[model samples]
Target: MSQAKDQEMSMPSSRQESDRTAAPSNTKSLTLNSTRSGVGTGNFGGYGMTNGAEKPSVLHMIMEALGLRNQAQNREPTSKDIGTLIMLGVMFLLFVISVTGFFVMWFTEYYNNTMLENLILAENSDTAKSWLNPDPKYDTLLKAHIFDYPNIDDYLAGRADKIKVVDIGPLTYQEHTVKDEVSFNKNFTVSFRDRKSYKFLPEKSSIGEDYVVRVPNVPLISAAGPVKRMKPLERLFVSPWIKQFQEPLFKELTVSEYLWGYEDKIIKLKSLGRGRRRFGLLMSRNGTSVDSVQLNTGEDDITKFSIITQFNGMPQLDYWEGDECNRIDGSEPSMFSPHLLQDRSTVNVFLQVLCRKVPLHFEKESSLQKSSEPVLLSEHGTVLAQRSDQRHQVLRGCAHFSLVPALLHWRSGAVQRL
Candidate 1:
C-alpha cells in the first residue's frame, strides 16, 4: 500500500488536473517534493483539498480505521532529520564491513598459517637469534639431591646391619645454554653445538656446597671390582697402585668437591693426558659442548620440527648396540607441534646427556590457570605422564640408559621437557 502510494505521489508533471481528478482517491496523482524522512509535501494521505474538492473513498476509510489517516501538512526537512538519515546509513555500512571481515577470518587459513610461518627458523630472523643465543632468564634449571651415609663409621665397624643414608641436599642451579657454531643447512635443518654453564643459587638450596658429608668411595670400589676380575699376577700389579692412594671404603668430602670436582690419584692416572687432576660426576660437563647436534627447523614439514636428525654427524647412534635401540631420534626439549598432542600421543624426547630418547606418554588432560587464557596440560597446572612402568633400559656395548619419568609443558609457541 505504501509502495503504491509513493508511486502515485511521484506522478509525471505532464498529467493535468482533470486526469488527477479522474484517478482514484487512494492513487490520486500528486507531486512528491519531500524526502522520505521528512513530512509529505503535496496531498498527504490523499486528504488535501482546495475549497473541499476532494471526496471520501475506501483508501480514506482503511487509513482512518488503521489510525494512519492524519491532517495534511507540509514542512521542509529539519537539520536534525537529515543528520539522523546520514548517521543510519553510516552505521549500516560499518555493520556490513564488520560481518564480512569476521567471516573471512573464520573461513580462511590466513591467521593460523601466518603465525606458523613467523615461527619458522630463518638465519636473520628473531627466532634464529633466540635459539642461537638463548636468554639466561629462561626457566631451564637443574635441581640435584645427594644422599649421605651419616653413620658411616658405625656401619663400617659392623655396629649397624645396613648402611642408612640420609638425604642431604636439594642443590639448585640455573642452567644457561648457548648454541655455538649455529648453521642453517640447505636441507631445511640446523646444526649446532651446545655450550652449557650452571650458576648455583644459594637461596634455592637447603644446604651450602661447603657442608661436609660422608659418602661411598666410588674410586676405590670401581678399581677393586676390575682388579678382582683380573688374574693373580695382574691383580698384584693393579693392587699396588690401589693401595698407594688407599682411599677408605667410605670417605668424608665437602658437597662441592663430591659434586663438581675432587682430587683422585686413580682418575688422574687414567686420564693419560695432561688433564685436570680433579674428577667429579659432572665436572667435564660444565661450559662444554660434548657433542654436535642437527635438527629439523620445521621449514618443510612441521611434524619434524626440532627432531634430532643427527648427533655428531650420524643419523643413528653408534654408542648403542642394536639398530632400533641406537636410533638417534626424538624432538628437542622446547619444540613440539600442538597437533601432536591432539589424540594424547606419546611424545619422545632426546636427552643429549642420556645419549637416548625417553618416551612421555599422555596421562590426562589439564589446564594452566592464568589471567590471559588457560593453557591445557596433563594435570594440576603440570603435564606429568604418570606411569606404573616408566623406567627401562636397553643394553648397548656395556652402556645402558635408565630412562626416568619426564614432564612436558607448553607456552605461547614452544614446548618444554622437564
Candidate 2:
C-alpha cells in the first residue's frame, strides 16, 4: 500500500510541470500579435487623416520638410520663355519708334514744301503793274544824248596844217545777227533790252536801196563805253545762273541783237577853182537787211521792208519752290512772254511776232499807280501772261513753243526732254 500511493503523487507532479511550460509560450505569442496590430492601426490613421487636423503621413511630412510642395506649386521660368518675353517687349518698342519716325519725317517734308510754295506765291503777288505806274513821272521814255564830229574839209585843212585830223565822212555800216539758245536744269531768271534807231535819208534814193545802212557794235560801244566796261554785261548774260544756287532766288536778262539804220551814200568832192563841188552817189543796193530776219511785204515791196525781232528775258526764278504751280506740267516759262520782231530797230514796225509766257506780276502798266494790287493774268490755270500787258498785245492767234527742258523732265520722270 505505501508503494502504490507514492507512484500516484509522482504522476500528478509531472502533469503540473508540463502545464506551466505551455502557458509561458502561449502568452509570449499573444503579446507579439497585439503589438503588430497596434502598429498597423497607427499607419492607417496617418494616411487617412491628411485632410483633417491630424499628424501628416510620412510622404507628406517628407515633402513638406524638403520644400518640395512649394517648388512644385510655383515653377521657375525656363530660359526660352524668359527670352521670348524680353524679345516681345523689345519688338513692341521698336515698332512704336518706327511708326513715330515715319510720321515725323512725313510732316516735316510737308511743312517745308508748303512754306516754299507760299513764298513763291507771295513774290508773284507783289509785282502787279497797276501798282508800278501810278505816277506819270515813271511813264516818260528816256531820250539819248547826241554828239557831233567836225566836217571833212575842216579835218583835211587841219591835217594839212600839221594838226592831226580824222576823216568822219564816207561812213559804211554793216549788220550782223546773234542767236542765243539757253537751257536750264533748275529754276532761273533772265532780263534783256534792245532797240533799233534810224537817221535821215539823203536827197536822192534808189529803189530796193536802203536809205539807211546798218552798223555793228556801234550802239553797244557808244552805250557801254568800252569792252572792259561792257564785261559785266557779258558775264551776266553768258552764265547768269552759275553761282545762283547759293541764293534763294535769282534773275537774269539777255539781248540777242540790236539794229540801226544810217545813210548808204558816200560823199565825193572835186577840187575846182579853189572850191570843191560835193556829189552823193549810191553804191550798193539801198534796201538791205538790218539786224533782222527780213520778210516780203505783199504789195509795198518797193518802199516797205519787213523785219522780225526776238527778245527773251526772265527774272526771279526760285529753285526751292516746288511744282505746286503746275510748273512741271509742261516745258515752258510760266510767267514771262518773249516777243519776236522782224526788225528790232524799227519800234513802230512789225514784221514777225513772238510772245513769251511771263508771270503777270512782273509786268509794267501805264494804268497802275506805282503801287497797286496784284494783277492775275492767266488764260487757263496753266497759261501765265507777261506783266507788261500794254507793251505786249496778247495775240490769241499766235503759235507757242515748248522750250523748258527741266519742266519736261519733271513731267516725264526722265532726265531728257521728250
Candidate 3:
C-alpha cells in the first residue's frame, strides 16, 4: 500500500509536467493559425506558391471562362459558340441589307420626282404643241375672230373697222330657244377741251332693246395714254366641284377705296321672251358747255343721265349681287325667264360697264395696282330700253361695248373700277 501510494505521487508529477508542455504547444499552434489568417492563403499553401508567386490576372480568368486558357488549345467548337458566331454574322448582314434598301428607295423616289417635274414643265410651255389639237397650226384658224383683240385701245381706235358688226341670231342655250324679249340701247359721245382733258356724255341709253348709238371720237385725247384693259375670262368662274370644297385656285384680295367714274346699270331679271326687239336711236348733244372743275354739262345738256325701269314698283335690279355664271340653271334654259308658274318668283341680275383691271389668270399674275403693274381691261356697260308693264313681269337685260377718253370723263361715279 505504501509503494502504490508513492507511484500515484510520481504519476501526478509527470502529468503536471506534460500538461505544462502541451499548453505551450497548443499556444504556439493558435498563434500560427492567427498569423496565417491575416497573411492570406499564400502562407497556407492554397492555390499558389507561398513565398513569391504572382496571383492569376483578369486575362487568365476570362480565358478560363471561355475555355481558352491555353494558346492553340485543340478542341472542337461547342454548339453554343457556333450559334453565337452565326447570330452575329446574320445581324451584320441584316444591318447591311437595311442600309442598302433605304438608299435604293430614296434614289428611286428622287428620280421619279425629277421626271415628274420635267413632264409638267413641258406640258405648261406655250411653245409646246397642244395635246388635243396636235398640230399647232390648227389652233390659229379656230381662234380667228374680229373681236378677238389684244387690248381695248386697239379695238376702239378704228382697228376693228374691218369687222363689221353682224346679227348672229338670237342667243340660244340648250334646246330651249331664249323665249324672252331683250332690248339694249346706248349712245355715248366724247368732246375734248385740251389734248389732255375730255368729257363723256351719254345721249340716251336704256336697259331693254337693241339701240345703236355711236361713240363719238375725240381726236385730242384718243391718241394719248394707255387705256385700261381686261384679262382673259377663262378662269373667272371656277368649277363647282372646286368651289364646293372652298378651295381657292387664286389668291384672295381686298382693296379699300377703289375709285370709278362710269355709270352702272343693274337689272333683276324675272323672265325671258322668244323674240328680241332691236332698234337704233341716234341722238346728239347739240350744244354741250362742259365745266372741267364741276364736271357738269350746264343747263343746255341734252344727255340722258340715267335710265330706270320698274316692274312691281321696284327697280328692275334694285339690289345687285355679283354676276355668277354658274348660278344660272343649266338644266333648263327657261329658268332664266321670270314666267315660272310659281307665284312671286323672281331672279336677280346685274349689268354694268366699268373701267377696271380684270383677273387674267387664277394665280396673281402681277401686283394688285394698275398704275404700279400691268393689268387687263374690259369694256363694260349695261343699258336697255324695254317696256315691261306690271302685266308682264319679265325683265330683259343686255350689254353693249364702246370706248371714251380717260381725261374727258372724270366724274366721281362715272368710271367704275374693281
- What candidate 2 gets wrong by more than 4 Å, as runs, is 1-77, 123-418
RMSD of each: 16.8, 29.7, 27.5
Span of 10 residues, lowest total lDDT, candidate 2:
248-257
How should the candidates be ordered by TM-score, best one leading? 1, 2, 3
Candidate closest to the true structure, highest TM-score: 1
> Residue-wise lDDT of candidate 1 within 1-418, one digit each (tens)?
9999888887754477657666755353332324332354433444554333445555455445544444343333456555665676699899999999899987666876876776667677787788777777664778878878777577457675555567866998888888888889999999988878888999999999899988766666666656889999998887887788767777789988887889888777667557777766666567757678899888898777788999888888866545655677887866666556766776777777767666666766656445444333333322134343332433343222323222122234332112
Model 1 C-alpha lDDT versus the unseen true structure: 0.68
Candidates' C-alpha lDDT: 0.68, 0.31, 0.30
In candidate 1, how many Å is residue 402 off?
9.4
**Candidate with more favorable, higher lDDT: 1 or 2:** 1
Question: How does candidate 2 score on lDDT?
Answer: 0.31
Per residue, candidate 2 scores C-alpha lDDT tens digits across 90-162 of 9999999999999999999898656434323121233222221123332322122111222323433444322
